[model samples]
Target: MLDADLKEQLKAYLERVTRPIEITASVDDSAASNELRGLLADLTALSDKITVTERRDDDQRKPSFALTTPGQDISLRFAGIPLGHEFTSLVLALLQVGGHPSKLAADVIEQIRNLDGDFKFETYFSLSCHNCPDVVQALNLMAVLNPRIQHVAIDGALFQSEVDERQVGSVPMIFLNGQMFGAGRMSAEEILAKVDTGASAREAEKLKAKAAFDVLIVGGGPAGAAAAIYAARKGIRTGIAAERFGGQVLDTMGIENFISVKETEGPKMAAALEQHVRQYDVDLMNLQRAEKLVAAGDDGLVEVQLAGGASLKSKTVILSTGARWRQMGVPGENEYRNKGVAYCPHCDGPLFKGKRVAVIGGGNSGVEAAIDLAGIVTHVTLIEFDSKLRADAVLQRKLYSLPNVRVILSALSTEVTGDGQKVNGLTYKDRGTDEQHHVELEGIFVQIGLLPNTEWLKDSGVALSPRGEIIVDDRGQTSLPGVFAAGDVTTVPYKQIVIAMGEGSKAALSAFDHLIRHSAPAESAKAA
Candidate 1:
């Protein structure tokens, strides 16, 4: 069931529907059918425009779902209950089918309308994959607009046999026309580009040529965007290369602690960030991975070499390369990353509701995660390798306040044990006594720490913390004179959205100051 605010939002979004949408389910005596029934009932009760009806079709072979107006057959179908992040997918799909405006670009909708052939998109996704929702929403919107396209978002956990047959290790693995098309989080534009054959192709192509610049930013996240915007405003040639713009923000879910904003989802914030950056002529080259970082030598020009051999050179560089999740380096950890084990509790916790789970690490992140999960999940076991929890006393108190949470200290997470299908439990060791024990649970959240994306600059003489985070001063200046760093990749004490944005602005301003102090007046001035 949706929260009050979310329910209100859904109501407002669905109120414009000029047509009635009936959610039909092929029911049986099974709990799965009942779950489908209950979820649909809650959804239909939201508005008079929506209705639910079920037929006792015990002989049906496939999963059940149908969403169309009464006395109409152009209904959308979902094979399973859209739980976890997929809940968003369900609501968005309803809106789209009920005549809500398409979230895709106008040109994209035109392209979708012109598509030929009966193309089916079978997207294998786990409810926990934060990247899955964007793709699902886009695909569902396209399906709503185009009659030729059929998008089915299947839960990888629910259909483990199909997932194993395809050897799917991660999601959302998208298959088009019954063949694997692509995987992971791709923009709606990119998805259409993959299925198109016209002008859109030329427009959506990844950077074909790299242009020289005065300041080359290595990332397209908040830090890089801030740096580029600041440099561009100074009339300096600025360029940015991002593997994917928005960095970790794309993999995040609900963000309530972003300062002024009351609430916003990750994808919405990411889109807005990109829109703001694009307002300036910051030569944004997305989908470009930075493979090497070269410090300026006698030439006094730094070069950021991308993966495809296109290099962008500039007078200054701001390393905003973000950090990634610190994986539990044990067997089956990688195997079942999205299958049952997850890192972002905010994105995945709802999937394990009424199910037992374990949190590895007793730091603020782990303890906070355990406390949050306690409300949704049946039980949460918090594990820490040290004698005491590293979290603040305040957070520890809040964590201890939860009755469903139990803390275990001096414990080392040994292995994430699971079936070939999905995670079933986890094995940890008593660090003090060297005794190993395994606890049965449906999920494991590894919240040890973040590993910075500064490995490319390791040999470039950038000062890094012992844990590999780029060390920066108060002014965002790195050890190297012309280089600055910000965001989670830097030595910032708290890795947060507002802090990252502020650090990015500081880094950009610092870079600009360096240019004015060291470079020629002609190059420093706007006219130059």
Candidate 2:
């Protein structure tokens, strides 16, 4: 908490040192509108502050104003709550009003600028999503580049009533021109394509698309978000498909070892990344789902059919559609996942230091957890259904070296014996002999493999590996020229957030290459 004298001194110092900035704030009539009014009043009091702009339409409805600033542009929403990383989003809006260039690469800027159309985007997000910040940045850039394009970002927490009113059930939902575009993380290019083509189709009464993007990425996971940012920065108009925005990262309890940023939760990190990528405006679609993806033209144009009877056309597509952790099918599993039964050891291991725990599954994940837990917990009992351990030689040696770790081969978890509140123990059975055993513990770690959320892409023409992963080259390119893949759902071995993000970046860069080459002919023809 800042003292009154300190706050006053800080405000005065800011006022004296900063030059005047042009920005505006608006207020609406509602119970939650006080926040907007207060923010405006505070800014108005400060030098180089946000100005108050109020206007009413003929119907006497208050308008949400777009205020211009030296470094960026801001959209004022009274009675709107910006929660989670949304506070950062608000700051980004101010930055946009201040005219700050986005953190995206130069190439993405060129690609998005070349596309033609008017787009109105509204992205609804919660503070929980790890990738929502990217979604906001993408939409904000669209709002910046084209005045015809309007973007609105709504916070889920502060506006629960409004969220319920809109029937938004999840984090990171985007609505393009009053249509549900899907949720989760989407690239700006994909979003713009949808908007441009949707409008064109509506006007012409047939499927009409003006331009084809080199690659379209779906899902803004570590893989998808990285793909969009890198692709856009490299000058590709990439599009994204998402159900809520952010992807599974948002649900992650905590994240550490993400490279540069050593320790940060999922939401904060996602927000920062999103802010960096929004500069390219790479056609992000939040809360939008693809119903069908069919090949369109010989030029590798793929027609993505959305759920709302709308269609988007793209030359190439990157399938960064990621995977979800397989839930423990036991009755108490859902009730105590984050509470006790954790899937990610890196994220939640520290929380159980010196505690007794058991690791489930027979594969490498389970063995790895047993080894990791041996150091953190008092006793680590590894339960596996297969008769033999599945870990590599080195990992097996490591697990054997740990005295606290014990392996139970041919064992399967029959029930997650818990205290009915949090996880406390587990009951397992031998697969071959039907022998049952019980272990006392404080936590349970489910180390089973994750399930890829690619059921919807069964016929999307993107090739999947035997392990149900989208097969991709080093650059995240799939067997198809236009389609790329990334993340855990892809063939990338490392399932860490950082690895997925890196793959996403690679995919985006590859997409940009495709676009630049495709547009070269058009650019040369125009030059001629």
Candidate 3:
């Protein structure tokens, strides 16, 4: 069942319906049926305009939901419970069926509108997988927009038999017309590109740079998108370069604490973010990661070296290359990633709920993860490398406040032990006594630290923190003038979406201010 706050939020979002959306669920003997029934019932109760008609299908191995208008059949279906991270898809599906269009770029809409042939897209996802929702939303919205396209998002866990038949080994494994389309997360542009059967996957025209620009943003995460949007409002030549736009957000699950939006999955929000960025005049360079940055001297253009061997230039720059989760580098750590070892508790924690789990950190994040996992999982073993917990006193109190959590201080994670299919447990060492010990847990949430993605600027002379985060001042200015930085890659402390977005806006404004103060002379020199 949805929580009171989340339920209220969903109700509010669903209030936009001018007509009822019919949901007919075929419940079978699957293990997820009761929970799925409760979830659907709760959703139906939220709005008078939403209704659920349940039928017991003896042959049905899994539950199915087909949302339609009155007396109209929509082939769009969900093959299992849409709880956990998939909750976003369910909500988005309802909205789509109820006539609330999820925004996409005008150009993208036009392309989908012109699509020919009957298309079938099946995207396999886990409810706890954060990256699944975006692809689901994209495919679902495509189906909603184009009647010729039928999208079915099947929960990979519930339908293991079908999953095995399809060889779906990962989350967001998509099949276009029953052919293995893509695995993991995807962007709207990429999804649309794939949907265009007439075009090759590489047929998406490469985004080229303008001769020059006033501001160029590197990295298309939340920060880069925000910066691009803000910079474009100034009517300046603004461009953004990113190998992949969503960054960490693509892998994230459900985001509940994103300020106003009570509940949103990573992929859906990332698509919306990209869509909003596309609304502006910002030049977008997709699939282009910045390989290096060349700082411009006074009145010179700063250059951004991309991974694809292309370089772009601008008068002012905003570095928003985001950070990645710090790895422990133990044996099987990489091997068992997504198999049982996960970096994001928010994204993958629910999958391990009611199972035993371990949190590997003594810091605020680690302690927070321990507390959170303790509530979800049956037992939580908190491991720390220090003699004492390094988290703040308040967080330590909250962590200690939990009864299901046990603390092991001065411990170093040794190896992630697994059965080859999934994580079964891990080994740890007593840092003080050097005694090796093994613990049994189904999941491991790594919360050690975040390593900033500023390595590309290493030779560019951007002053970085000892840990490699870009150092920026209050105004979001980097060590070099005409260059600014924001988001997790910067030394701005907290690494939240709202914080990154706000920092990006600040960086863009500061870049504009810097241009106003420094541009006249550069223009005059060009004239002379």
Candidate 4:
């Protein structure tokens, strides 16, 4: 099923296998099963250590296969053809099961091995989803590391009955032991923290014991990564505490405007940013959300209080907390989230294939989402609050060209109507006529805009604009002394990745200049 070039690459990757591996598949007379057989045949032809066997009477899902080492009790299964974004997941599973060393940190590997009890994880994913691979690869690695853990990555598109029965309207929807675990992109560390209840407390204690940093960045998006690298290059203690590295960038699908790079996806760019930051002597902490920022007191240090009662002290702080998707904030929106309401068209569009959906916005994101969905869904209704489309003229032309798309101008989304279990329609009102209307649909994609992640800074004595963005001078200096801000969270205009990175570098340099000119009494005495 793989092309010639892909086969050559697969062969090169399989050369890393140090042990024998077996593939046991359960198939029926179906097109997907035949395709799975072809894939397995190609895989077996690549490496001498690989073999495949088929058993029709197995109790597992049809068109599924299990990869296992001969002498090991570990096994990772795929209940559907794992192509598209999941192709990397398939390669990683093959090499990992065949004794290839994993790249996870030693501590994280040990933690995975130490987890108690059996974990049966099943993740539903669509092939087009950019965020599904992370979740699939993480769980697959965990299953490979721990013998008690078993994971099955299921293709939601291929298994319509299972998707309908579980009411899975979004990609990367995970379930552990038959109960819903979570939805969306999740890292291995996040998964471990959830299953292991004491993991958070242990992590908090570790954070509390860390020494004060010279420059500490709050956020791990493009801006935070740039700040950490710049500070570390100056031979100072630099650290980054992020809720989730990559921030809103992780949710993005296509990025073509990032100068130099012709085209790339959000997850790939995020990985590159993280990899570049790791080359420096920066303390990288993930999944840590800053709850409060305390201004400098008697010790000339700023304190950042974490959500789990852990506080980090730093001489200078750069806030690049970034932004998140703006919610519609209408009735039933929250109650039906993931059930039928979604913000990411790239991630959740495939789940609503052949169904009717609504795009709530008229800007570039919304217009683009409508254009993309028109090809997959039966029909798309584009709702906009403005009288005219805010997208580029080219995009508007393309959107208008689609026969399956209908645009509604000067309309306001009032409420998201659902059938208690899932969304069935949407309610809106025409602005000019003040006439209420309801459109029957299966899903709603919200692409309004972004809101700065500065709610925590509201009572923290930091000067903020009316829109809740942190107010900063040209030097990236915030109203609070020794504290600065950057990226989408700051007052800087044009929230682009390149701009954020530049702003982050400027903020780091500004912080360093402050340190050199206004050295603390102890440091000045030491220099003497």
Q: Best-fitting candidate, measured by lDDT? A: 4
Clash pairs for candidate 1: none
lDDT of 4 by residue, 371-408 (tens): 99999999999999999999999999999999999999
Clash count in backbone of candidate 4? 0
* TM-score for each candidate, following the candidate numbering: 0.77, 0.51, 0.76, 0.98
Q: Write the per-residue lDDT of candidate 1 for residues 346-435, one digit (tens) a residue.
A: 656656767899998889889989988898889999989899999989999999888989899999888888878788898889988999
RMSD of each: 5.1, 11.8, 5.2, 1.2
After superposition, which runs of candidate 2 have C-alpha atoms over 4 Å from their true positions? 1-212, 298-300, 328-382, 386-409, 414-427, 437-445, 516-528
Clashing pairs in 3: 130-253, 243-288
Q: lDDT of each structure?
A: 0.79, 0.65, 0.82, 0.94
Candidate order by decreasing TM-score: 4, 1, 3, 2
Candidate 1 lands at a TM-score of 0.77
Ranking by lDDT: 4, 3, 1, 2
> What is the per-residue lDDT of model 3 for residues 450-473, given as tens digits with 9 covering 90 to 100?
888877788898999888999999
Of the candidates numbered 1 and 3, which has the greater TM-score value? 1
Summed over model 1, clashes come to: 0
RMSD of 1: 5.1
